[model samples]
Target: MKTSSPSDAPRPGHSSVAALLQSQGALIALVSILLFGALRYDNFIGWQNVSDVLSNSSKFGLIAVGMAFVIMSGGIDLSVGTVAVLSSVLAARYSNYGIAPGIAAGIVVGLLAGLVNGVLIARFRLMPFIVTLCTYIAARGLALIISDRQTVSISYEHGFDTVGQGDFLALPIPLWIAAAIVLAGALLLRYARFGRAVLAVGGNEEAARLMGLPVVKVKIGVYVISGALAGLAGVIVASQTSGSPTEGVGWELIAIASVVVGGTLLTGGQGSVLNTVTGVLLLSVILNLINFENGYTGGAHLTLGSYWQTIARGLFLLAVILLQSRLARRSP
Candidate 1:
């Protein structure tokens, strides 16, 4: 019998690097922004400004947290934003249907969307890219059709305001919910048997199947989870705005960017929910800084606006992929 050396058995040296990146990427990025802003702008790190960033980031954080699971399972879901729009619209319609039906309708629609993706990917072995892209188009079109290409306002729904405007411990209800979901997701992914199953399936599907893991089921399960969360995010967004199908374009890109920036492997298998959370915050923070600085400067810097953010996201993704490729080549 032969035993592997302690150093060779997933020791502290290399493992910590990924962990650090996941846990502190946002904080480090935040610090970097402050340092840069402090040198460049007069009021980059003000208190109200910080809150604004976190507040704005929370919505994207909700979707990114869900996207983390999908990406970790070696899959993608481009339809999340549209599903969210569809769900939010349904939620508003449900207001007429009553609260229970509204919530149920929204959740069911999202679950069904996930089901479609999961079935195609797991049972039919379709590529995640094509499947999700089709759903993206389908879901967005369906949302437009249902809403008649108009925003459906749910201001009349009883307690509708509470869903988005309520507070918990001095934080917004949506933020609290996001935090709770993140905690739950982190726990499930890190400590549960199901979590390991997800990781194994993503890391090596054939091996997971050989080990008797329910690979198909796990993959399907993650898509469902992702869809459900996306739907929930939509509901929250609708609640905040009192309208549906109005603000859900390009959200998938934001979610995907956060997932990648969070340290999740684009190839799948290696990542963490916490990292995704940080990534979302990091992005939100940068955008917040941009907005704050712009406000002070009279919005003269349109170049530092959403377009710049998109370019930053692309550059960050390219950098991470290249770094990972180099590291993979160096590793055993």
Candidate 2:
């Protein structure tokens, strides 16, 4: 038997602390922010304000859930945002047909875009970053073309707008939809063999392949799922805003930032849908706070402009990335 020195042994409590930081850090931060906002603002804790945060966060939360899956599978989908825009354009165009057809068309568009990405990456063995980046541009162009570079409004008479605006069980329709997606995602990731394969592939593709895992299939499947969710998000967005080809601009960065803030490794192989939801709420709350701050100081020399929100987002991204780097180093 080989004798090991104390220095070589795992540090007691370190693993637990790191795990806590990785898993619950975003939750902690979100709670702190909520407390701060409630204390700092007279109306931040009101039901109306709370509802706004939850409802607005749902759209990004849906996208972030998909992003968590892709990032966990060691891949990225830059096209998700523009793909969403394209889906929204399609949904608006088809809204006159009926709500069912409109929703189906939007989702199908997303699925098709995802399929192209999956084929390029899994079949052609292209880099995910490059493939998704190209698709991102293409999707944006397609959205612009389909909508004639304009906002397409959905007719309210058809009830198509209810998808985003309606309430279920006293919760916003988008929040209900988002909750369902998150629950389904959590189950699939925690209890499915496909989910295991995803983790294995992300952890080490070559090793997973050698172990007889369906690496290619898993890789392709994650993108498909991501695409489908993004599409659903697009439909919700279209319903909420009537419709717009220009929507979802820069949403990809927001999704990525949410994932990172949620403690998902950019290198992949570890993450949680629940944590990603927390991250979405955190970002949403920050933006909402900025809005409140701006309103409170309106017409004042010290007013924090909308640009301050952008700067704050960038800084938050930087801080999360740094934290991720440090956590990676500390992990055994």
Candidate 3:
């Protein structure tokens, strides 16, 4: 037998290093931010601060989970945020008609928007980017029209307010809702046949189709699901804010960043929903820590504000893209 080289041994050290970089970016980021905040601010880790972070995380967390599903299916949904805004507007409009109708209207709008995106991409072979962009604009315009460019308040609806604003054992209802969604998403991704079809299609559409997968239906379904989740998030935000159409602008970017930062590939096919949850929590914690630290430093919380968060998220996307590109190059 040929003599074994030192490099051929198991390379445990190298493997560990690779695993760390591959799976721990969000965790590392979370830890670094926590340590920095704890050192820089005395109250950063207090229960109040912890609650604040989770509350903030719930909103984008829900959106990010849905976006994860869409991204995993080899697509994107630029329209999610705008569709959310549109749904919120509709929700507020129908609140006077009763809670059931309002809730129904919001979900229906979301599903319809997703259907538009899915049909365009799956059936017409249109690019997801262009299709979603068009829907984004259309949704925003529709929202503005419905609200008459005004803010509609739903403070009178006790049930609606409870969905968005109530607390459960001292935690916001949205957090519980988000956690449930995350768990459901994990199950779907891990065990559902439809979920497997999504992964297969994303991995190689031609091969997946050749293997008799319902590639087109799965693609469309995920987009629809993504839109529905976004819509649900909008309703929650509206309830939390006491009903506001302006709640969802720019949220799509945050959702996209959370999904990507959590290790979901923009190129699609491989990622974990649970990892995406970690990514959302990490960002939320970092931003909350920044605000807490800013107060200690005697700086305005609104000064640099979320601008730094946006910058950090962009850098994260760039880094993951570079790292993944390297992995792809080395794979052959």
Candidate 4:
């Protein structure tokens, strides 16, 4: 009988460590940042600042969630930001029709836009990057035309404003909505057959097809989900800012950054919804710290403005990419 040596035995702890790094790395980073901020700043631990962070993070969190799904499916939706703005424009335009109608209209527009993306890419075999880029331009123009290149205000009396600004249990309503989306996304990606198929397709499309998976349906479904979530994000933005056609400009980059920082592979087939949330919070905290630093110095010493924030974001993205590359190389 052959006897197994120490080196031949499987090392469970090693695998566990690797899994933890893969799944909760962003969470670890977030916690570290939070601790650092709390210790370094005076008001960073204040309730008001915390609330502000959660509230502001909600909109981007929602968009990032959808983008996470798309990225996991080996696809990208560059138009999500513009799509969100378009949805906001439509929601504001329909606000007078009643709250339900207003919200429904925004969601429908998102669904329709997603359908177009899905059909074009999955059916016609078009490149996702080019298709979404085209939609990005078209959606922006549509938003401009619909809102007449102006900010469309939602009536305060219609209860539509409360969806974003109101609070429950002392937390902003948008935060609650974002939490719900994240939970639902986690469940979908964890326990659903559709989720498994998405992973399969993303991991290996040809193999997925050979395995009798609904490759086209799964691909299209992810885009539809992305579009609908982006639309919901738009509605939330409209409620918060009284509606604006140009609200989500440059948000696509932020969403992508969040996904990348969350430890999700840009090549797709690997990501976590919870990690994406952590990524959003991490970026928000960093921005908040920058604002605090700027104000603390009274624009004299460290007067880093929005441009600095952009640079910081670019640097953070570069660091994450380099880390990912090293990790990938180390993996067996």
Candidate 5:
């Protein structure tokens, strides 16, 4: 008889009802929201709006994809946002050289940062939260110092302008890049041996270790993936708005929220990258719906402030978590 891996062992909170809801609820909500928007708002599902939504969500999607891997492995990286800012500054400073150089430099820096985080956590056995938190603080500070606490405008030389501004198949280039990354991530999670290892590591590290899994390598790899994606997001930011010392501030929160809302447990393991994407899209659509509401009602539906959207995001996350909790409690 086949034996269950440590992660797959019978345990509390693995309730079938809760698990099913977590796995399927996010998609259902997303579909319902889309239907509502399509009915209530004119052209809500139109191509141009869809393009804009996808473009705006692409950067976050990248970060969330990496974050998903980290979380699924029962780890967290608080530095992703600040890492993106650091990479953005680097990319902008080197933009005069050429498109490829700038992009490469940014991604390389991100990889290095991730490697540092991985070593500190896996090799040194430091707590992931504390290690990543320190990295977050340091990365942001370095970004500010390197940029002189100012925005570094890109030269846009050597076809560098095409990255963010370009389009393919009527979709934004950033969206295309983000899509490729997400697809790659999905493939890694679905069919790769490493994917199973990651879930196992997250589900029960000690058990996985007993099974002879390369726990250290798995931990290191997830962080590297997170850092690489953060770097890519930074390059996109530089392409769109140049590099600001302040870019990507608090982006980690957005990534976390998106993942959680997508039904990924904060405890790690038992999650889906595809659901994460749906969560990203759902949040984006909510923002879009909010804007449409305000436009249609001439500000009657919402207060006149940017913070409302933040509040909405917060409320949405809270609601989903509560529902998940209630369902989890109902698990028998």
Candidate 6:
């Protein structure tokens, strides 16, 4: 009888405490930041600020959710940010036609880009990093070509801008959209067959193949998802502001950071969508606190806004990563 080694094959819900901490660590950090901000700044926790934070984080949320799935599949997507840039430009350029057409155009751009990536990686067996990097460059160039190197402005007659600006039940529409996406992602990862296959593939591609799991299909599927979501994020960006080929530069780092901070292992397999969302919020809150700090300092260091944000986000992410390592070691 070949018995499964406990270390090699953990049962479901194994190391519940460690798992709990790994998932909840970001939540705890977010709460701590909020409390600290509240104590130091007037109206720091005000509803208006809260709403704005949610709205601002929504774009990253969409991208990050897709990123989490890709990471869980033991792959990476450097093209997502640029794909979003392409989608935003497409969305803006098509806005004059009508809302539905504009939205469709953006989604189509994303879908097509994702399909290319999927085909290249899964079919050709190319390195995901290289394939996505090529896309990162190609998408940006395409966006620039389409927009004539200018921001693609949207016509407001179709009210397509409502996606980024409108409110629903007193909350931002973007928030609702992001929330819906997050919920769907969580449900799919938690209960769907495709989700299980994804985990299996990430856990061990060769073993998953031996078990008759469709490894090619899953790989292609994840890239498509990452590309499509990135495109959707671009649409949101165009709606909120304008689409520029330069918009999503370095944004992929944000998605990777969010995934990592949320306890999604870089090595793949184990992850949580909800925790990824928490990571997004946590980073957003950290940026918000930076703004609050500047205000408290009377804007004496306003010039350091971007630099400070990078520093703060980096430090927080580092902390979460360290915490994740510790918790992983503690897990049985």
Work out the TM-score per prediction.
0.85, 0.93, 0.89, 0.92, 0.91, 0.92
- Going through the candidates in order, what is the number of backbone clashes in each? 0, 0, 0, 0, 0, 0
Give candidate 4's whole-model lDDT. 0.85
| Alpha carbon lDDT at 48, candidate 4 | 97
Per-residue lDDT tens digits for candidate 3, residues 39-140, read: 777778888778777876887887898899999988999999999888888877777767777777788898899999999999999999999999999999
Residue 261 accuracy (lDDT) in model 6: 89
What tens-digit string does per-residue lDDT give for candidate 4 at 1-332? 99999987647676566556655666776787788778767778899999999999998998999999888989999999999999998998888777887788788888788888989998999999999999999999999999999999996778888888899998999999999999999999999998888888888889999999999999999999989989998988888875687778789988998898888888887888888988888889878877877777433446687898879867875775566555554444
- The reply for model 5, stretches above 4 Å from the true place, is 1-19, 298-300
lDDT for each residue of candidate 5 in 61-162, tens digit (9 for 90 to 100): 999999999999999999999999999999988989999899998999999999999989999999999999999999999999999999999876676657
* TM-score, ranked from best to worst: 2, 6, 4, 5, 3, 1
**Position 116, candidate 2: lDDT:** 88
lDDT of 1 by residue, 283-317 (tens): 77666656656666644454466787667756765
What are the clashing pairs of model 1?
A: none
* Total residue pair clashes for candidate 5: 0
Residue ranges of candidate 1 with Cα displaced over 4 Å: 1-27, 35-47, 97-100, 297-306, 316-332
Give lDDT: candidate 5, residue 179.
Answer: 89
Better of 2 and 6 by lDDT: 6
Model 1's alpha-carbon lDDT is: 0.78
Question: Which tens-of-lDDT digit does each residue in 1-332 have in candidate 6?
Answer: 98868676655576787777777888889889999888878888999999999999999999999999999999999998999999999999998998888778888899899899999999999999999999999999999999999998998999989989999999999999999999999999999998999899899999999999999999999988888888889888999998888898788999999998898988889898999999999989988888877778544444347876798779778988898789888677
Question: Residue 240 error for model 3, in Å?
Answer: 1.0
Which residue pairs clash in candidate 6? none
Q: lDDT, candidate 4, residue 150?
A: 95
Error of 6 at 245 (Å): 1.4
Q: Tens digits of per-residue lDDT for model 2 on 8-80?
A: 7668688667667667777877788889878777799898899978988887988898888889999999999
Reference-based TM-score, model 6:
0.92
CA lDDT, every prediction? 0.78, 0.85, 0.81, 0.85, 0.88, 0.89
lDDT-wise, the better of 1 and 6 is: 6
